[model samples]
Target: MEVWLNYVFGLRPRNFWGLVCIPLFPLLHGSYQHLTGNTQAFLLLGWFILMQGIHLFYVVTIATALISGVGAWLFGPPNSVGVGASGVIYGYLGFILMYGIVSGSWIALLLTLIIAVRDAWRITGNKYNESQLLPVERSPRMGWTAHLFGFIGGVLIALALSDMRLN
Candidate 1:
């Protein structure tokens, strides 16, 4: 059902309508396998974001989704449908990473570094890394475009919001 919803609402690369699907994209998944892959990042990152504050969490989530969707829609492979929360997870990762540097939060920086090393290690050894890296462009495969865009989005949002009293 969610998958079907994804087909109906997922972001279409280079399509203007994709903007409408930005917020919705995070709510849909390509498959159970895809959903499962994203679940841990979503929960863990989401928890950490919430730890900052409910409002910050909401702001980061929505901003990342919108920015990620725009990025995928504008720069992703044409005529393709992209859906998943991995982008948002990437956004969370980016937010934490940038938050540490911008706000001088050592804990956030350390956590982001640890995650990056772990994921980088997995990609280096895993035969499936290529597929995961360009998943959306490859068709019926895991793509990292959303993740990249989401991370960028998160960084942008964090930069914009870090000055606020977001404690």
Candidate 2:
């Protein structure tokens, strides 16, 4: 099943159309666990991004997808097909974290800080490590590389928009 899916829909390194999978793969999930994890992160971070404004939301979303997708296609494992929304969520996380820093908004900074602390605590205090602070690449199936690249993508976009005085 995994082999079949990777061949067809997974993001393969150096594959041109697989580049399309960069944006599209985030919309796919390998299992219920994968879907729920991405959903929670997306909803929370997405809310904050949405608060910035609807137009910015669309802008950031598209930017994250393209940047994150391209990064994965260029640097991801040769034989693997990356999938899941962790990249986008990580992008959102990066945007929030950097936007606060760039804008010098105390409220945004505090909000980002709180989330950081909370995630750290969750990872440290949990008995089973149920929650993670950063997206950790635990399985060959989990695309943590995309998460990382997506985060970098978000930070870059936020930096680019910092001078616009969006805050």
Candidate 3:
């Protein structure tokens, strides 16, 4: 019975909610470039989490993604299409911060501060095109909100699922 299940969904696949939200990404953004950029970052950070352990990684990613995506949809402007794994990335930030706090390790602490600062830097400035303001849909939804909520969801899930120590 267990073997048959593994062949199907590939085991629970952490944060299952997030994976289900991937398709909604196209609805959120109009430009392929914007989507691609977020997707690339998501893939990289996702790998970082995966290295920790498949089950833990999957659970955090999926859970954060779902919570963040739903948050965006609910809190974001009306009629706005929303999608992207940025929230999951944000959730990672949340997890890292809490993980460092819980474990009090230098690596976890430094990594969290470094990543959080770097991302904060990017979203602070507006990327412009010559003289005209671009469509919100075409622009990268680079903001701290996703990371904010991602962190919230991450801490909640991480705490509930297991004791995470970033060693």
Candidate 4:
């Protein structure tokens, strides 16, 4: 059942049918490890976003998914089927970090710092042995493309909303 869902819902780059998966990819995971790996970060970051408000939470989530999904679809490795919530996780990371910077919120900044310190190893660790000489030369299984795009989307959304008063 897991494999079947992943097969049907995973993001397929450059395929018209894959477009539908933009909203669905984050809901699917390839394995137990994959799901667990994303769950912690997703919850942590999502909680911070939710602190701002429920409406903003939905906005950040939906926008980040769209931007990250489209970006992965455009630049992801050919024929790769991407799955997992890492993109949204990364999106949350980006949003919180950028929001802290842009909004001058000490709480946001402190939360960002806490997350950075706690996850520093994961953020800096090299998952691939190769130097990744090119942006596209990533492990097809890693969803680095989704991470990158999702981070960008999060930052963009944060910037877009920076002017608003946030809690």
Q: Which candidate comes out best when scored by TM-score? A: 4
Assess every candidate by TM-score.
Answer: 0.82, 0.83, 0.62, 0.88
Candidate 2: tens digits of C-alpha lDDT, residues 93-149? 788788878888788889879877755543232554333324555444545566667
- In candidate 2, position 8 carries an lDDT of 76
- RMSD of every prediction: 3.0, 3.4, 9.7, 3.0
Give candidate 3 regions above 4 Å deviation: 1-23, 26-29, 122-147, 159-162
lDDT of each: 0.74, 0.73, 0.55, 0.79
Ranking by lDDT: 4, 1, 2, 3
Tell me how many residue pairs clash in candidate 2: 0
Clashing residue pairs for model 3: 14-58, 14-59, 15-59, 15-62, 15-63, 90-147, 91-150, 94-151
Across residues 110-136, which tens digit of lDDT does each residue of candidate 1 receive?
Answer: 776887776663222254543243343
**Comparison by lDDT, 2 against 3, better one:** 2
Maximum-lDDT candidate:
4
**Better model by lDDT, 1 or 2?**
1
Model 4 — TM-score against the truth? 0.88
- Clash tally, candidates in order: 3, 0, 8, 0
Query: What tens-digit string does per-residue lDDT give for candidate 4 at 1-167?
Result: 98988888899999987888889998998878778877877787898889889999999998888888998899887888888877787788788878888888787778778877775544444563321212544454565777778888999999999996566
- Candidate 4 stretches with Cα past 4 Å from truth are 127-140
